[model samples]
Target chain A: EPEVTQTPSHQVTQMGQEVILRCVPISNHLYFYWYRQILGQKVEFLVSFYNNEISEKSEIFDDQFSVERPDGSNFTLKIRSTKLEDSAMYFCASSSDSVTEAFFGQGTRLTVV
Target chain B: GIQVEQSPPDLILQEGANSTLRCNFSDSVNNLQWFHQNPWGQLINLFYIPSGTKQNGRLSATTVATERYSLLYISSSQTTDSGVYFCAVHTGGGNKLTFGTGTQLKVEL
Candidate 1:
């Protein structure tokens, strides 16, 4: 089965540094999303992308975060000046449409020191 | 915004035992999905029961959209089934999924 693939299974960055997490969604998927889960916390939605633009974002998705579909197959999330609280598992997901079931990637573990 | 509540935050079952997990949502949803986060933290998709019943192998799920609740049944559980089960729902027309608190199940041999 086709799946969403994320790069760098784990990453460790210093505070105030920048990090980019990349994902390649399923080829035929039309909607892409970025979500994060703090240790022992709920999975939180960060942003959703469609048509090469951000369709919606949550309050947690502030100025420090940005997402881009740099190419037809690559979707990326960039966090500028990482904070200690930013340490979490970031998941990338995609779906055929906005309302369909989305498939998730294995997730990228981001650790900020 | 919608609220999702999962019952019995934790459960312990012996191998070959049966279990039922429940999820309750605060509002109507356009999509309802059940996912299992394994010990290694991989979110595995189990079922996408929005308003009906679907069974796969030893697992089955039923969602009553009007009632705003869904149930996941695991029959003859195995140690491999040990994981945290989460029910996620998308309300309104948004693409974001709001996840429930999760039910942690540990099936021991």
Candidate 2:
């Protein structure tokens, strides 16, 4: 079955550094999203992208975060100046439409020191 | 914003036992999904039952949209079924999913 794939299964970055997490959604999927889960916490939505632009974002998705479908196939989430609290598992998901079931990637474990 | 609450918070079952997990949403939803988070932390999609009933193998799910609650039933469970089950919902015109607290299950011999 076709699946969403994320790059760098794990990443460790220093405080104040920048990190980019990349994802390749299913070939025909159009809506893309970024979500994060802190250890032992529930998953929280960060942002949703459609038509090559962000459709909606949560309060947690502040100035430090940005998402882009830099290419036709790749969607990326960039965090500027990472903080210790930013450490979490980042998941990328995509769906064929807004109300369809979205598929998630394996996720990237971001660790900030 | 909508609120999601999952029941029992945690469960333990013996191999071959059966169990039920529940998810309750505060408002109407356009979509509802059940995901199993494995030990490796991958979210495995189990079902997308916004309403009605759907069964796949030993697992089945039923969502009563009007009641605003969904139930996931696991029959003859196995050790591999040990993990956290999360129910997420899509509300209004938003594309982002609001996830439930999750039900952690541990099936043992």
Q: Which candidate is the best by DockQ?
A: 2
Q: How far is candidate 2 from the true structure (C-alpha RMSD, Å)?
A: 0.5
Candidate 2 local lDDT, residue A100: 93
Using Cα atoms, each model's DockQ against the true complex is: 0.86, 0.96
- The residue pairs found clashing in candidate 2 are none
Worst 10 residues of 1 chain B by lDDT: B90-99
Q: What does candidate 2's lDDT look like per residue over A2-76, in tens digits?
A: 999999999999999999999999999989999999999999999999998999999999999999998899999
Q: Which stretches of model 2 miss by more than 4 angstroms?
A: none
**Model 2: per-residue lDDT, tens digit, B5-65?**
9998999999999999999999999999999999999999999999999999999999999
Q: Candidate 1 lDDT, tens digit per residue, B1-109?
A: 7999999899999999999999999999989999999987889999988999999999999999999999999999999999899999998777899999999999999
Q: Alpha-carbon error at A76 in model 2, in Å?
A: 0.3
- Candidate 2 chain A worst ten-residue window by lDDT: A65-74
Model 1 — interface RMS deviation? 0.6
Tens-place lDDT per residue, model 1, A1-113, is: 99999988999999999999999999999999999999988788999999989999999999999999888899999999999999999999999998899999999999999
For model 1, name the residue pairs that clash.
none
